[model samples]
Target chain A: MTEFEEIKKTLLTIYPFSEEHLKIFTDKLSLKEIKKKDFLLKQNQICNHIAFIIRGSFRLYQKTEQNELTIQFFTEKNWVSDLESLMLKQPSKNYIEANENSKIATISLLDIHNLMEIDSSFSMLNSLIANLTFPTTQISTLKLKSPDKRYEHLLLNNPDWINRFPQMQIASYLGITPETLSRVRARIN
Target chain B: MTEFEEIKKTLLTIYPFSEEHLKIFTDKLSLKEIKKKDFLLKQNQICNHIAFIIRGSFRLYQKTEQNELTIQFFTEKNWVSDLESLMLKQPSKNYIEANENSKIATISLLDIHNLMEIDSSFSMLNSLIANLTFPTTQISTLKLKSPDKRYEHLLLNNPDWINRFPQMQIASYLGITPETLSRVRARIN
Candidate 1:
């Protein structure tokens, strides 16, 4: 399937928009390519577009004075955006980076307004914020689990993330030291 | 204005809907009252309704083996519900309780469906989750501040909650001990 085809399929799966509506949406979308280790958004910049993943993946992180913290990951068939920045029109405190060579279907805030103008009940767009909060569930993980349990929870939820991403990224996401992550893996094994 | 009038007024302020639409939505809402310490929802129970506070306030809490942590607070004119439990139909890990004698205008999930049926663009009903996530901004408080700074934030953002709630509840919400909270207050004074 084409990259556009994957985006259309994914949008349909989430919101069940009709083919006509998907055409209205996809027509406004432009596909963007990013190489590995490049950013879709840098810290303190306004996020200009929302994307539906067609190839590879992306990771969002927050850089504090102490360290860079991984906030979330998005792979093919997922919608990716800095929702707080997009909604509030503020520079985001987070960074969004392409995890590998990636193709993404992108839409600006204006495209979103156009779509909402088209369908008052236009819901797939609403579902994007709901999807964004799943990673905010990470905040709960930090609250609700010990470090070891958090590692186990990450693997159980997204084993593909573990297998595909570098160890350092996963360790940062799990909010543990690389040494601690290695020790946990050894214990689990 | 009556409590119901305030609810109607607040609803219009957030999402402008005609009287006809407001009647369709509000006709389904029943005003319910609760006394201090009674639960709107209990841990492991599904949150079956969303409410707009008519009078008094509420607190959402999480109980572990060692602690009962206050996750959020809601006051008059605020909306309250466990959005995760309401949206996903999962049993919630948190409890919502009245902090004082309280009146609330409430709609069941069935009422929400009825409203959505009336208008496919039925966004006010859709907005309850977005409203719920606003308080989940408390999660950011944990990440962004030390205990003292968190206490300062509580005062800055919600002076009414600090003035109305007991010091213990405020301490719990700030993730600090009562003695520590007292010390912080004394130092400030």
Candidate 2:
């Protein structure tokens, strides 16, 4: 339907907000479109906004002296933010870049705090979302999985990640070399 | 002070709970002492409780055919649980084991849900704690740092981990071998 419709649905799915409260929540969000390869956040910058992807995808990564390591990927309906930076008001050490032309609805940390003060439901919703997206549980286990198992796991859970993102990026996200990913794909095929 | 005084202080530090609410919260918690090498949770079992370490420490880890990988460590005042399992009502794949004789205060998931229903403040507190202990952000970045850098970071942030835990466990937690950890420590010193 509309750009905000997906985020509203997502929010309602997490916690039922009163119509008045929902409107208040949505009113605080601002929409922006970014071109492919544009950065949503960069290392050493504070991430002040939490964004819901309305369209397209993003790669959360970090650059070392030798290479860029992809940590996570977000597609439409998914939320993206450097939670550490946003919550702690500290500079982030990672980068969030658009994988394609993307539209996102974002609310600032201050607005979120204000809303939490305005209504307790907003706080509950924030906690529910945080729990739902608890990355440590998944990523910690994923890091220990074999490359083939990791690829198979991703293939089963989020096939769109495999089909939508480039193989190199996917390999980086999986913490494997392109050659290793190729071998895993070949064996699986 | 008392066993729960630390947890109460920790909770109040996160969100200022009214005396009545704080008492209700503490009243619901049950204290248990676990012996060294005792398990709070095991693979394939559902984790129904989130425990606050009132004393001693724990290592959250996953067992593979070859090794047990330490995913996280929780000492005094730190909260421990398979959050994924507790939130989703699913069996956990990781084990939470006491690294020493430990004392903990635990609340069941059902009790937490009931508390949330009783007071919106409980829900807000849940969200705030979830946000505060957002593990994914830290672990994702930690995975990419070099062994020496990782050890240095840990040394600066939680030197108790270095002083208290066995070198082998610390090495496992760092995703490095005991020998590598030795080299890293030697170079740092």
Give the winner by lDDT.
2
Structural similarity to truth (TM-score) of each candidate: 0.78, 0.80
- Candidate 2 residues A1-189, lDDT tens each? 387777778878767888788888889989899999999999999988888899989998888788887878888888888866765567988899999999998888678767766665676455434533667545554556588888987888789898899999888777778999999999999
Identify the leading candidate in terms of DockQ.
2
Candidate 2: C-alpha RMSD to true structure equals 3.7
lDDT of 2 at A87: 59
Please give, as one word, the docking class of candidate 1: acceptable
lDDT of 1 by residue, B48-118 (tens): 79888888899987887887777778988888888767765679888999999999988897667656555
Candidate lDDT scores, in order, read: 0.76, 0.79
TM-score: which candidate is best?
2
Flag regions of model 2 displaced more than 4 Å.
Answer: A16-28, A108-123, A137-149, A178-189, B16-24, B108-124, B131-153, B177-189
Model 2 lDDT at residue A28? 90
- The TM-score that candidate 1 achieves is 0.78
